[model samples]
Target chain A: MNFTRRFTLAGLLAVLLPVSATVAQVDSLPSWNSGSARQAIVDFVGRVTREGNPDFVPVPERIAVFDNDGTLWCEQPEYFQAAFALDSVKAMAPKHPEWKQQEPFKSFLAGDRTALAEQGEQALLTLVTAAHSGKPTDEFSKSVADWFSTARHPRFNRPYNELVYQPMVELLAYLRVSGFKTFIVSGGGVEFMRVWAEKAYGIPPEQVVGSSGVTQYQLDAAGKPSLLKTAKVQFIDDGPGKPSGINMMIGRRPILAFGNSDGDHQMLQWTMAGSGARFAGLVHHTDEVREYAYDRQSKVGKLDEAWDEARAKGWTIVDMKQDWKTIFREKP
Target chain B: MNFTRRFTLAGLLAVLLPVSATVAQVDSLPSWNSGSARQAIVDFVGRVTREGNPDFVPVPERIAVFDNDGTLWCEQPEYFQAAFALDSVKAMAPKHPEWKQQEPFKSFLAGDRTALAEQGEQALLTLVTAAHSGKPTDEFSKSVADWFSTARHPRFNRPYNELVYQPMVELLAYLRVSGFKTFIVSGGGVEFMRVWAEKAYGIPPEQVVGSSGVTQYQLDAAGKPSLLKTAKVQFIDDGPGKPSGINMMIGRRPILAFGNSDGDHQMLQWTMAGSGARFAGLVHHTDEVREYAYDRQSKVGKLDEAWDEARAKGWTIVDMKQDWKTIFREKP
Candidate 1:
C-alpha cells in the first residue's frame, strides 16, 4: 500500500506520457487480461528461465512452437491461405482462359460462396495448385508479398497480417526475450508464409515450418539458379503431419506449444510428451462479437479432439473474450 | 617496427603462457597458416561485416554452410558415416543369424574389404537399414551416441569426432562470433550428424540438412508418442540434391559455402548464384601424413568436375597441407 502511494506521482507522469498510452504498452502481455491464462504463460516462462531451479530449461533447448492460422491470427471466413488461393485464381484467370469455365474456379470467380463451400477443400486445393504452380520461388514470393500488401479481411476490414491477435504477438516477444526460440508451425505453404512472417511476427523465414510444394533447383548456363515450384504437394503439415513436420524441420520436441484447432493436436501432444516442465495451450474462439466462434462444428480450424484432450490433460484453455484485453491490434 | 620493439617484453610473457604461446592467439584463424587462402577468408568476412561497405551483407543473411564429411572431419578410407554403418551391422549381427548368410553382411562381417567394395554403396545401404531401421528416433540417437563414445578412427587411433580439422573448427567459431548463422549441409545421415554435431562443432540438429530415412510418428493408447525410423529412404541430399535440400530445409541461399568433394558442387554453385557478396571454397585434401590426401582420382569424395569448375569460377581452392597450420588438432 505504501509502495502504491509512493508511485502515485509517477503513475500520473506515466499517464501524461504520450507513448505510454495504455497499460499494455508498459508491461509484458499487456494485451492479455490478468487471468490464469496470462499467469500460466508468465509462470511457465519464469519457471523455465529461473537458474538453479529444478525445471530450468537451457536457452538452446527452450523451443516454443505456435500454430499460425487460428492461434496467432484470425482464421475466420477461410484460412488466410485459402483466401490467397482463391484470389490467386482470380489474378491468374486472365492468363488461364480455361479457368474462366472451370468448375471450382468458375464458382470461385462468380463469388458463389455457398457453391464454393459445397465444392469442398479438394476442389479448393485443385484450384490452388493450378493457380500457383510451375513458377520460380522468387516470383511466388513477390506475388505473395504483393497480395499481403493489399489484401484485407472482409470482416475486420484490415490487412490480413494486421489481424494477428495483439496478445499472441506480445506473448511471442515475451517468450523470445525470455530465451525461448519461437517457431511458426502451420499447414500453410512455406513459401507463402516466409514472405511476411518476419515483419508480422518477428519470426524469421528459417524458423517457419509449414506445408511445402515440391520445388526443384535448376541452374541455367548464364549462372542463374531458380528454385521452381511444382504442382505436387511435398508435406501436408496438418493433423498427424504436425509432429512429423516438427521432426523433419525442427528435429527436437518443443517445450511449449499453442493452437486453436484440432489440426494442432499432434503438435501439442508431442510438446507435452517431452520430459521436464512443459506448457500446452489452446486458444478457444469463444467470442462471437470479437471473432468468429467455432468448435467441433466449424469447417475450418476445427477445434474438437484438441479441445477435449487439452481439457483432459489440464492444458491451458484460453477463452478469447475473457483472457484477452484486446483481440486484433486494430482499434475497435 | 617501433610497436614490435615496444611489445617485446609482452611478447616474451605471451610465449610463457601455454594457450597464448602462438601469435595466432592474438587473432582469428590461428590454426590457418598465413597465406592467400587465409587472407581470402579474412578479407571476405571483413568486407561483408564492415558497415556501409559496398560488399557488406546483413547479419541475418550472413549464412555460412559447410559439408560435414571431409570438410570438417576426416572422411578417408571411408566416410565416418560409412564406418558407423559398418560397425552398426556388426553390433546387430548376433540379433539375426540370417545376417551371417547375407551377401554384403557376410563379406562385411568376414572383413573381406575387396568383396564388400565390389558390393558397393547399395549393399552397404541395405545392411545399414537392416541394422538401424524400425527403432524409435531417441533409441537410434542413443545407439549413435554409444558408438561415438567407443569408436576410434583406425588410422588416427582417436575418437572420430576428435579428428576434426582444427582450422575449420576455428573458422566455424569465428563466423558464429561474427553474427553468421552456420549450418551443416552434408550428405551424411541427418540423425547421425545430429547426435555429435553440437558437442563437436557447436551446430544444433535443426541446422543440419542431410539425407534422412522416412520417419513415422505414432501415438499409443497410453498417450505415448514415438517417431519410428523406417527403412525407406527420404532424401539423399547429394550432388544436385544439395541445392534442393537447401531450398526445402533452409529456404534461403547461403552466402558462404565450403565442401571437399563433388557432392557439394551444387551447394557451392547455388550459394555463388545468390546476388551480392558470396564466397564458395573447396578444401583439397593434400596432407597425407596428418590427414588423408584425396581428389579427382579417389572413389570416395571425388573432386574432378568441381575442382575444374572452382578453378574457372575463381572459387578458393584450399590445399590442406599448405593452408592449415594444424590438421587434427592433435600434437605429434
Candidate 2:
C-alpha cells in the first residue's frame, strides 16, 4: 500500500479500535489467552487510568516504552535489522569487490554465520554502517520502506511487517486507548525502524526512539537541502543506554516498559524505579512450534539478567507458549 | 500554580480557545495587531489545516517548534535560566566557600557582570554546571520550580512566568488548537526548561527539547532509583544543533519553526527547506519602551544573521513594536 492508503487504514484502525476497546471490554486484547501475564497488563492499565483511583496517572504522564526486536516482533533466526544489513551488504558487493576479501564481510558473504559471529562487535558495527550509511535520510527511509515492502523472512516467507506479534499490536493499540503514549525505544537504527513502525505498529515516527548515527545537514550540488547519514555513531539505545536514550529523547520517565531481552534490562529498571504506579513486562519466547525459541544462550535477543530480574522484581513475564494464542498477525 | 492546577487550566484553555478561534474569526491572536506578520501566521495555519486544501497537512505532520528564551518570554538583562543559575551559585556558596576565590565564581560572586562577561563561554559553562549538577533529576526539578515560584524579574517585579509574551502564548495555544503539536527547541538546559515549561506554556516536558548534561541512572543505598544530573554537557540545542536536536527528539521535520536571534537561523533554514507547506518566523525585539530592544550589537540575543536571512528568505519578521498590542501577559 502507498503512504496515503496506509495512513488512511491506520486512521480507520485508530478510530475503530478505541471504540471496540470501550464497547467490547472482553476482547480488548483478544490475541492473548486469559493468563497471569495478560491479567497483569490489564490490571496495571486499569489502576493507572481509572479516574479518581489513588494510583491513577494523568494522561500526559502515561508513558509506555517498548523494545522493537523481540518484544514487538520476531528476532530469532537473526534480528530483522541485522538480516536487512546482511542483505544490503550482498546487494552492494558488486560495487565494492574488496568486500569479498574483507575479514567479516568475506565470511558474511560466504554465509559463514559462525565466522562472522566470531569476528565480534567491530565486525557487526562495520556491517551495519556499510549497509545504512552514505545516503540522504529521505533516500535511506525510502530504501528501508522498499525493503520492508519486498523482503521476506526465510522461515516464515512473510514480509517482516507481517512477522509482528498480533497480541503486542493489540497491546499497543490498547495502551494508546488507555491514554498511554507508546514509544519504541530500540537498539535498531532509528531511520530503519521509522520507515515502517507507524504503519505496522500504530506508532508514529515522532514517537519511535532508537539508536542513530551522526547525520550531517547539507545542501547538495543542486542546492537542495538534505540530511546525510554518516558512519559515526551518535547513540546506541540498548542495555543501559536504553534508559539514557529514553531520558534524552523522551525527557519524561516512562511508567510502563516492555521488552524481551537483557537489552531491555535498564529500561524496565528505570521505569519501575519511578514513583507511583508502574508496570514492566518481558515477552518470553517459549513457543518453538509457533516461533523460534532461543533466549539465554542466543546470539540475538539474549534474555538472562533481565529474565532473573523480572522474576525477582515481580515484572510480568509473558510466556509466548502460554500467554499468547497467536504469534504473527493474521492477514486481514 | 501546582502542576495539576496548571494542567487543568491548560485543559480548559485547550477546550475554550478552539471554539473561540472558530467563532471569533476577527481576532485569533488578540495581542497581535492586524498586520502582514499576523496575516502570514493566519494564512499559513489556515492553508495547512483546511480540509481538502492541497497544502493541508495531516494533524500528525503539523509539528511546530519554538525557541523558549526571547521567542516565548523576555530574555533581557540575561536569559531567565542564566539568572536562575546565578542564584543557584549564590545559594550554594556557603558550602563551596572556595568559590569566593575561584576565577569565574569569584567574579560572579563580586556582582561584576562585566567581569563575568569578560570570562566568556568557559565562565558561563562553569556557572551552568555548578548550578545544575550533583542532584537527582526530581530534586533539580523542584529547585527550578521553587525558584520560578518565588523569583521575580528585577525590572518587572513580577514572576518570570508572567513576563512571557502574551501574543506568543496565544499563538502557541492557537497552533495547538489548529492541530499543530508545539515543541520548544531551546538553548537552555532541558531539565531547567522541562521543570516549568508545561506549566508556563502548556507545552509538556516531552515536547520541550533543549541542551542537556549527561545523566546517570543509579540506585541509592535504600534501593531507590534516581537519575542524577552530572556536570558534563551532552548536546547543545542551539544554532546548528537545533535542527539536529529536533530530528533526534521529534524524529520528524517541523512544518513551522519560531525563533529569535542568530541561534535560530539553522532551525528556520531546515524547516523552510522541507518540501511542504512550511513557515518560519523570527521575533524582532523592537519594543524598547515595553521590553528591552537589542538586536545586532546586543550581548544577549544578537539577531544579525537571522535578521538579514529572514528578509532575504521571506521568513516573517515579527516586529514586536509593530505587531503586538501587548507584551507581557497581564495578571488576572
Best TM-score among the predictions, by candidate number? 2
User: Chain B TM-score for each model?
Assistant: 0.89, 0.91
What TM-score, over all chains together, does every model reach? 0.89, 0.91
lDDT score of residue B71 within candidate 2: 97
Model 2 chain B worst lDDT run, 10 consecutive residues: B15-24
* Clashing residue pairs found in predicted model 1: none
Task: Give lDDT tens digits, candidate 2, residues A282-313.
Answer: 99999999997877998799999999989987
TM-score: model 2, chain A: 0.91
What is the overall TM-score of model 2 with all chains considered together?
0.91
Top lDDT prediction, candidate number: 2
> What local distance difference test score does each model get?
0.83, 0.85
RMSD of each: 7.9, 4.1
- Model 1: residues with Cα > 4 Å off, grouped in runs: A1-26, A100-120, B1-25, B101-107, B110-120
The Cα error of candidate 2 at residue A25, in Å, is 4.1
Q: Against the true structure, whose DockQ is highest?
A: 2
